[model samples]
Target: MTGTLITVAPTGAESSKAAVPALPVTIDELVATAKECEALGAAIVHVHIRDDAAEPTLDQGRLRETVAALRQSTDLIVQLSSGGAVTDPEADRLAVLDARPEMASCTMGTVNFGDGVFLNRWEFIVDLHTRMQDKGIVPEYEIFDLGQLTTLQRLLAQHGLPYGGHVHVDLVMGVPGGMPGTAAALVACHQAIRDLPAGSTFSATGIGRSTIPVILASLATGGHLRVGMEDTVTYAKGRPVESNMQLVARAVGFAQLAQRPPLTTAEARELLGMVAR
Candidate 1:
């Protein structure tokens, strides 16, 4: 099996300091956590900025602060959330691509937020993807459900690179009203992503308790993974995880047991076709 790239999403919009107190939120905390995750075998750190009281926001100033702190300590690839809080509509969501940290996640299509619908029209999607391409930043495609898969296909077709050098894809599963967590669900997501062009790579991430289930299934099926308190607070069934690095270490151990070695930061960069700085 090809080595896996373990990306640790230290803090996300939905997960809380209360749910997982060790979750990284502030600039200092996030940088520290990203460094620790890197130490624990994660090649990439997926970040979502939160406010002083732990509320998620993609506010430009806060994102700048968080990323600056991250660079001071490590060169680990930082992927930001353009899908912040799902409730924050289209106008409120965007990647501050000005910093251009090698990679960022771009949601293919919007789905329902808890009480309302999340919105990302073709204009926003195309504009962001175009911006990432122009900036040479790899945009990790996020698909919350099957319909979003088609949306990604449409974008891929529109881009049509000379050698299919499209941005990477991340199959995000287990959101409410989105795809359920099942082995079959994992298979379906794999098939959808594999249907894309030859060069693009994909990763699997599941919300809440389904995180490890999907990770392992993805591993068994030859796919990369993302994990941490941001996705699931538990270390195992009924057990609480203490930190993001703990989850990363557990994933590394599981991958070893499955005979799937993890991709180093350099190897991960190669897999995603990123240029070295």
Candidate 2:
């Protein structure tokens, strides 16, 4: 098996300009940065797009353009996010993957986003899994907490869903209401994944300060690590990150020190079992 499969989430749906200066806002910028990350050592580029009106709309046409641009520009594995700034309507979330990127985000459970709710109703999740399968796009199951992994297993058992042999999971941590990304918490989440239905591949990512501890723990366990301005903005203490690629470069060194070699884009895709674009 290859080492850590670093998925560079250049821009999260809710990642703001205030948090990271070089956050990709335009399609051209996002595609350019994704290619840069691939060159720096990223296998998968997870994307979130905006509508024609500049709002975070799930316009399929815009998404197609983003995917096409990235494909034309780089050999990196492209992964679109089903997560939206507003995830109430599942159709809206699935619209981006209607263009059929190699992989799409499969957020597994509901979460409390500040004062509001980020609900992933049962019906939509099941239906979206089928949609992703119909388009031949593999899913990277996203878990905000341990319980959501259960949702993923249930959907897999019920529908033989997602239609892909390996389901890639992004174990998210330190999202306030979600699992705290401490070393022990990170280990606990990885343990929970071991009990998931057979044939599932998993990786861990931490938000804010928890990124350091969670990433270190993941490395110790032979699990892959995900880092970007989307997960964190600072490197250590109060220092700021120059770019998403900078964070990725730092992770590459960390992987080596942890006795694991960093994966190239091709190796990362193979390790994650994603379809190469």
Candidate 3:
């Protein structure tokens, strides 16, 4: 198996400091988390910035500052989240790419997100894809369902190539309204993506109880991983995680046991075809 590229999603739009105390909401906390995760063998930090109130935001200044801090403090690849919060306006979502980070996320399609809807229309997806291409930002396509994989195929067919030309995707499973997080489901998703751009890679993230199963499946399937408080707050049943580094450490241990150690920052960059910063 290839060296696993572990991406640490330290904070997500859904969780808050009150719910997950160790969540890195502030820039300082985020930078500290990034450094520690990198030291624990995380090659990338998938960032979601929060405001003073600890609410998610796509504020250009905050994002720009957060990106700068991560760049200065660690060698980890900093990827900004364009899926800021479900309620975020489309304009603000598009503006996130303006922060000019090395990487950003582009959801393949809309899905029922719990009680609410996570909206992503074809026009919005195309616009984000084009803008990322213009800004030289590599996109990590976020897929919540099997059908979204087909949407991605259509995207590449119509848009030619995404920014950076290399394709990387994230299989976000076990959401309340999306695909079930199971070994069979993950393998099916992986098979579907095989028709994508040649050499396209993927990372699997199983939220809540599905976390461990997804990690094992990805490891066994020659795919990468996305782990942290963003997708899971618990280290085990009834056990809340203490830090993102803890989650990353466990992933590194698993990868190594499988003979696929975590990828270094430089190796991750090369694997993803990212431009040097």
The best candidate by lDDT is 3
**Each candidate's lDDT (Cα)?**
0.78, 0.78, 0.92
Candidate 1 local lDDT, 76-125, one digit each (tens): 88777777776776655654676556677788876775566767788899
Clashes of each: 0, 0, 0
User: Ranking by TM-score, best first?
Assistant: 3, 1, 2
RMSD of each: 2.1, 2.1, 0.8
Clashing pairs in 3: none
Off by over 4 Å in 1: 161-166
For each candidate, give its TM-score against the true structure.
0.92, 0.92, 0.98
> Which of candidates 2 and 3 is the stronger one according to lDDT?
3
Candidate 2 TM-score to native: 0.92
Number of the candidate with higher lDDT, 1 or 3: 3
Candidate 1 accuracy as TM-score: 0.92
Model 2, runs deviating above 4 Å: 51-55, 274-277
